[model samples]
Target: MKKTTINYLHVGYWLLVLVQTLLVSLGTGVLGTTFDWRLFSQIVLPVKFLQVLSSAIFFYINYLFLIPVFLKKGNVIKYLPSLIATLLIFTPLYYFLEQRLYPMIGWKSYDADLNFWFAVMITLSSNFINIFLAILLSYLMDWRTMRIQKEIIEKEQFKTELAFLKSQVNPHYLFNTINDIYALTQQQSAEAPNALLKLSELLRYMLRESDDQFVPLSKEIIYLENVIELQKIGQKGLSFVNFEVVGEVNKLKIAPLILINFVENAFKHGTFNKKNNPINILIIIHEQLLHFQISNQINHVKKDKTGGIGLVNVKRRLSLIYPEKHELTIHQLENEFIVDLKIALYD
Candidate 1:
């Protein structure tokens, strides 16, 4: 409980008990004296104060020690006995301090003589109320604590999944680059050194930024440029390329490796030039949106090399990360293929 709430509840409870005691005292006025402020301030105040203090102390001890011990031992039935013991321990301490000790200290007693049965009944009722409230409070505390634990576990699981996904991107990109290098080496061309250097630069990016989930848009563009340069080395004079970046390059950030796959797919499947259509790519940032377009010519009838799987993976990732925040389009017009993508940027 918040300290303020506990304090209010503590005071409110005792005030209720004091009012009950006053009513009882007033109801018995016919047998003795009537309700008087002088008597209350001098006698009733001292008794009420002692009763509240003793009750509070006993309640604290019972909840802090007795209840936990009972729960730990799985002794639900022992709660009644524990409550009885707590009352037995506190009642005398309060009665003795108010009636006996205060008398010695020159404080008048708000004393009443009743049949033993009535006192016993009052004590039993008080014990019942205490036990009921304590159980309810403890259950609320346990429930709130358990809810917080569940939230922590869910957050941790999400972090683990994100880390796994991030790790997967690095190796997947590296494997594709390695395959490119192998193809170039098999040809035994003069461009092999340049290809190796490009591979080294790509490896450097993977090592330095692999652990990062997000990178500057400019860094990704530079990496894509390196890949394109490396691909050009093997193409010799046979390949024609048209690359354009429109608009100013400002402080924009995006998920790493998101655009690379489209670039890679274009180069892998659309290299032939029968229709005079070479690889064309456009990447621009305008009004806080990343606009990308890539198209290449497909001359021969390839056997659905994509198999409708790789792009599916990208779509799944976009849904998981961006949901309704992105747009993508694909078209295959005779010998020409095209992909268009647009994503919002934060900066």
Candidate 2:
């Protein structure tokens, strides 16, 4: 609970205590009996206020100190005895104060009504109420605090796992890309520097940006574009990789690396040079929804795996991050494998 809310509860609780004290002191008999203004003002009202104040003291002492310091550690030895001692000490303090305050404040004291043992029993019972309330509210607060902490820890652990899943990659992609870069350098190809730059940006994003829970949708699209560009570079620019985007991708954020694994799989195991069955990648955004679809013709022989994510892990990530806000479907035919993913984006 919030601090302000807790403070409000405390205020309301003390107000009820005040009301309870009034009800207990000035009972229905006060309405029935002859009005004794002196008794109500001097004897009953002042002593009742003192009783309420003492109850407040006992509540705070137990709630803030005794419960946390001793009972929280299950130290009954210190906790129980300390509680009894506190009760004994404060139970009679009221009568003692009353005796003194009556004389000093020049308030009329009804000596017969102020019996010592009677006052102690009353104080003891009220103190027990404080004890019960203190123990109950203290533990209730502790439970709420622990639940909040557990949720925070779980969210952090979830992010750590998601980032680990995103970072997993097959080494062959780097090897092939590096080889492509070397070949380009040897042949004096113009795309070599841009390919290297794209590789640098991809790595930078994978290492740094992907660690964030969400990245700009625009940045993710650029990352996807870079991946396609670099993969084409490795195939000597002859790979028929068709990429398209539609609608607004700006002012929106998505979970990082969410779409990359499927695209990489399409490039890894799909036909590259066939014009009739080329790889198809599309991204569409409308009204805070993103639609990502990718499909490719089976090459008969599986190509090298690139960036890594099994379907199981990707599904788990989507469930963890987006849950009911996302939908995913996969389709496999004799010659083609297709993946369709849609997500509710955040702006």
Candidate 3:
């Protein structure tokens, strides 16, 4: 809480207590309540002044010192005795202040006609009310502060983990692409110039757009298309991957680079039999819902190991970003591997 807010709570609570004390003192419950100015100023004011000041002192002592030192540490034994000790110390001090300060200030002192133990009991009971309020407010404020801190830490973790995943996965793909461009240059192939240009565009997209939390669906689609084109060039102009987009991509947005891992995974693991498309990716959009599917023929020669961030990283990303907003299913059939994913988009 802000310091001003906390101050307001304290001031308001004490004011309420003072009002209640005045009401009881002036016989509020007894039908004809009369406000005697002299009685209020002389007797009630002096007594209430001492009561309120002492209560406020003990409240801060318990709130700022005792509670954290004892109760928060689960030391109830020490905490309860500490409360009793402070109440004992402050109750006697109230009498001493009344005897000395009231005469000096020319205000009449209050003396309730009761035995010593009975007066001590009454004082302890009233003091406990202040203690109870202090403890309640302290726990409430501390709990809220801890919860806010947890949420901030979680958000930071999300960003850091996402960035880490993005960084770890790309070196493998970029290395292969660089090698392909280098071979094309050695042969002086005409496609070499175009490949280098496309790589430049891809690099620009990664550095500029991929850092964002979200990107337009059109930009993501274009990025994917450019990736497929570069991969085709890397394969010596063979069409081993097929990508299909259904429905309008306008006005839609998605997490940047979210879909790239599945495509890269397909290229890493799938066999090209020269019979059918080695990798097939299909994406469908309707309203704010998206359905994505990718499948590739099993390349038994490939194993479940890669230097790139793999399916685990992608799964973690989807959970963190989409949470209950997405569904994913993976199937490993005898001859093919398939991934089906659905996401509910947000504005």
- lDDT top scorer: 2
Worst 10 residues of 3 by lDDT: 107-116
On TM-score, the stronger of 1 and 3 is 3
Number of the candidate with higher lDDT, 1 or 3: 3
Tens-place lDDT digits, model 1, residues 49-133: 6655665566666667778788546887896688677677665665566457777745544467434445445555655666657
Q: Where does model 2 exceed 4 Å of error?
A: 2-50, 65-84, 106-113, 169-171, 303-309
Number of backbone collisions per candidate, in order? 0, 0, 0
Residue 279 in model 1: shift from native, Å?
3.5
Q: How far is 90's C-alpha from truth in model 1 (Å)?
A: 3.4
Candidate 2 worst ten-residue window by lDDT: 303-312
| Alpha-carbon lDDT, every model | 0.69, 0.81, 0.81
Per-residue lDDT of candidate 3, residues 244-286 (tens digit): 9998888888988888888888887777545465688899999
Q: lDDT (0-100) at residue 25 of candidate 1?
A: 55
Off by over 4 Å in 3: 1-4, 19-53, 70-82, 96-119, 136-160, 271-278, 300-309
State, as a TM-score between 0 and 1, how close model 1 is to the true structure. Answer: 0.64
Q: Which candidate model has the greater lDDT, 1 or 2? A: 2
